[model samples]
Target: MEISWLGHSCFQLRGKNVNLITDPFTPQQESAEPPATLSKINASIITISHNHPGHNYVQGVGGNPRVVRGPGEYEINEVLITGVASYHDDEHGKSHGRNTIYVIHMDDLVICHLGDLGHALKEEQLEAVADADVLLVPISGGKSVTATQAAEIISQVEPHVVIPMHYHPTPDEQRPAQLDKFFREMGVEAIEPQPKFTVTKNSLPATMQVVLLTPR
Candidate 1:
């Protein structure tokens, strides 16, 4: 599988010769990053974890993607997408609307997008997270979990790889910090990957680690 970060919580993952994008927000809005145009492809699966301005702008993501409103399970196009229910805002799932987290499992990899997740997991939620090869998280403060909470989830899920998102304030965004605090809390050497990252089943590590993607 190959992955590209399209700023904020939007990540484009290519697997099974197709693409999957998560939580797309319009750059004109409160978004800090602009969309990455990979003209070669359209998003096959678009997962919306929440309805926030930063998490759900159909236009910014571009193309006609089969949007998945998650918190449950669906299998299509040789990919299994399981949506785990969560809270959209802070206040322990009390604010905004219900948040959805997606788990994309394919031939060689399992990817988890914790879209604007506001709180930690219960035992069942932790069980769902444990299956991921890569865990995509929100590191910025506010409604989403803090660096401390994210660090705890990482400990519980123990994924082979972690992709931190939802921090990083570009000149365009008004947010405070980026993924640095989350990295320090996790106590791992963060790798600033090329705009895109490729992985095969054979290359997965047995232990968990954090990977910070360089935005396009």
Candidate 2:
């Protein structure tokens, strides 16, 4: 599978048979950096984490893609998707509302997308996302989990590869940088950002590792 970070929490995943886009974000005027111009998005499926404008700009995405919103189990185009009910805030949606954690099974690899997860994992949530090959996590603490919380979740999930998202990498006038703090918690000094990432089941590392991808 090929994973391309579009910006913010948006990612375009291309598998053998289908193409999926997760959390497609529209740029906010007050934001420091603008999101990618999502045009000609030939996606077979689009999984939304919540109804927030930055994560739910389906109108901007091209192609008549099937959109999945809430929690459920679905199988489309030979891909098995399981949505686990989660909260966007520690108070169970009282603060930020509900968030959906999507686990996608494709090419014999499990890819989990934790959309704006505000708290640490519970026993049930951990079981639901067991044996994840690739984990897309949020470290911004901007309506999501903090760097310390993210590190704790990583220890619990034990995914083969963890990709940090939803955090600002550079100094932006509109947004505060969070990657530095997250990296400090993870004991990572620096990470070279790549444009995209491609991996298969056989290519997965035995131990957990963090991979940074530059928004395309």
What's the TM-score of each model vs. the native? 0.87, 0.92
**Cα lDDT listed for each candidate:** 0.76, 0.87
Highest TM-score against the true fold, candidate: 2
Model 2: residue 146 alpha-carbon error in angstroms = 0.7
Question: By TM-score, how accurate is candidate 2?
Answer: 0.92
Runs of candidate 2 with Cα error greater than 4 angstroms are 29-36, 171-177
Off by over 4 Å in 1: 29-41, 90-92, 169-178
Cα lDDT tens digits, model 2, 106-177, are 989999999999999999999999879999999888699988899999989999999999976564523235
What tens-digit string does per-residue lDDT give for candidate 1 at 1-216?
Answer: 888887788888878766787887665545544544433347777888877776776655546778888667887688889898878665656666688888889766889899888888878878887888998988786778889898888888888988888876567633345555676788755555566777888988777766656776
Worst 10 residues of 2 by lDDT: 168-177
